[model samples]
Target: MLSADRMRAHLDNARRHLDTARSHTGRVATATGTAAATTGLFTTAVMGESLLATLAATGLGLLVLPTHKARQPEPEKVIERTADGGMLVYTPPAPPSHQGRTAAVLYATPGVGLVGVLIAEWIVPGFHWGEALAVALWSAGTWLLRPARRARHMLVPPLPPVEKVHDLVVQDEPQLYAHPAAQWWAERVAIEGGAAPATVLEDVEKTGESAMRAIIRASIPGEPVPDISVRRLSALMDVPQDLITVGPVPGRGASVQLLTVGQADAAALDPARLWAERIAPLAMPGATITAINLGSMNLSKEDA
Candidate 1:
């Protein structure tokens, strides 16, 4: 299998090639149009060749273009060293990133431009040059106008009512908050686990009471601690509070909560662990990770 670093380098090279091709195709189209107009023979074989060549160049340029991919951390691998110091294996996380809409725009722009040029060159035989220029100007004007209108609509969506329930969760507990469970649980876990107790405590205080309550609730399912904030997990999970109670069990003569779960879970609950696991790995000797392919099947197959 190709390494992540190798894959990234390959994609970068592909992007550069596509960019260069696009530039060359644009130049070809401009030169072809000017030549056809000055020569006054749009129906000739030479004109057809120029038009087709421009389209083919633009198509090839679009075909090789690279799209942006999101970077996702690999799955946690709990490696156990053998006598020879070789490590045991575990499954990695699946890739998470995808191409954005800009890629579609990039692909469509050249294709559409090619079609327009071809139609203009072939259908009109001897249409006035001014009419062709006017059509191009009007199309450009419409494209520019639509995006501006869309931007205005996005800028002013309707706001929710003030009375509606809204919650904000943090990694730490909050002050002036009614939920004692969040504060108690966070401090207890940090102290018992010998995790950074001071930092954990400080996070709880900064997150606010509402956010802390939501974190506690989400962390421990079926444990209704209090009436808090948002309904969606995306909002609830983001509570800045780092501590999460994975489960509760009787330990050391009391019902103590299990603070840590799997390695991935631990990383999610603790910022230090997360940074160490995800970012620190990149610093390791020969450690290089690449994003999964974001292009279409044909591109992926070609790369393979």
Candidate 2:
């Protein structure tokens, strides 16, 4: 039996899948129309060719066109709670690369036949029934040869033994934040930064106060307190005015970290608020937001 939360999550995932399918259907419809138009033009240009011959040529083209093999159905993987109170998800390894080689060889037969026919017409003195039969046999033989060629190349090549290392190198790097919360925050900030500075500046001046006030007023269910900064907190909570600081809490960790502090009007804040509302549900659960600091740190290194 599935938990209520798990069932709801599954339904949400289904809805997302349906939306994606609708989007794809629209694209497929456009592609089909374009392909029909192109084919009609091609038919007009080749008006003298017999319909049967044209179809044969098209069939041969389809067979010869280089395409990756039909993808194998992935094994169904189930996620379940383990005895250790952790989630366990089964992930299957990828299918072997050469699994479809035989199928590819079989499909190449018509292309080989078309080539053989062309060759016979050029080489033979006259187009005759015997010549046609010879071409057909040659084509079949060519198609059968492909699988043998693939098999011959299947042996794994031996690797060279490694020699002693000449140099040792070590570099210290900051550990990157991999959590979805960090990624979402970074992406949101990047998008906001990409907007016209003049427009953002205007917004910073106009709606900054109202947005900040709104953030403080909005109720978030899980947070310990309304702890937030003017910049990030405002953005997260959809507050307009740029947040400068907050009332100090007893423990330093209890207070929200201030990410930014700057002048922002209520107007500029509206867009950020709208963006926050759009992405809030998708953010990592239990993640806290800080204000955006627009100090020297926010400036590009090149500009600095």
Candidate 3:
């Protein structure tokens, strides 16, 4: 079976290849269109028409040259091993998007065509159909080469006003944030588990195939967060107490983080043994252990 790292590597390589192919394809289209237009210009019998067509084709070629857009690198977060033999997964918030810049480019692209038309008129005194056609083709090619913006819909749309919601809407997918379980779990923990009233789920960080880290925050102003025990957290998370570790988030006073190993790991460890061996070491060393792929740590009785 292929590992997650290998799969990610393969996907990245494929994306690079696709980007190269897209660049080549755009260049080829521009070259072919410009060449065909130029050839027709020379073949025309009328001297005046041929001159106009030749000038138009030259202008089209210059305008149609592919523009390279520099891609921004994505921000990456890491799970670091703290000196106290614990893992701290810190994921910074995503940066603002470049949609505004993209919109500006979209709006400015048509100006290139306008500029071509103005230059063509300067070269050939009167307005000609040949120049108009070249401008239109250049504009079309520019729009076609660029990727179109897609309209996005929320996976779970916001609730309407209290009077409008006649029916109940349920969200699924317990393991991830794309559904209701993550939010529900946090709310339940806050409301029923006697955490803070303003507590909310910050993020769900997956450590490996065998474990995940859930970050919950209590948002009461000017008040210190109450200590939440592992027993209560385990009950809220629906896992064995031994499989869960509750810790305070450094620098974030009202926030707490919980690490929960999978049930398979539970069978391998005698209550709390898994934490000392796999995760606790991260806290004790103080060194950042960046690469961790704990794939199914189900061992036999002798191995345990």
For model 2, the stretches where C-alpha displacement exceeds 4 angstroms are: 1-127, 147-187, 191-237, 240-304
Residue-level lDDT tens digits of model 2 in 174-278: 334355434334345323342111111111112344322111111223333333334554556464553444443222232122233445565555544634542
- lDDT for each residue of candidate 3 in 1-304, tens digit (9 for 90 to 100): 8899999768766766655674575455445445443443333234345345545644553343232232334778879999999999987765644643453355344334444544554566454678657755774665465421110001112223234365867677433445354666555666644643456565564555667655665556566456767677666667788887666654344445543445443344433444444455545543444455766878999998
Error of 3 at 256 (Å): 4.2
| Ten-residue stretch with the least lDDT total in model 2 | 195-204
Our tally of clashes for model 1 stands at: 14
Write candidate 1's Cα lDDT for 93-202 as tens digits: 65543332444454445345545655565666666675457446534543444332222223322233334244644365444335454455454432433232321222
lDDT of 2: 0.41
Number of residue pairs clashing in candidate 3, backbone atoms closer than 3 angstroms, sequence gap of 3 or more or interchain:
9
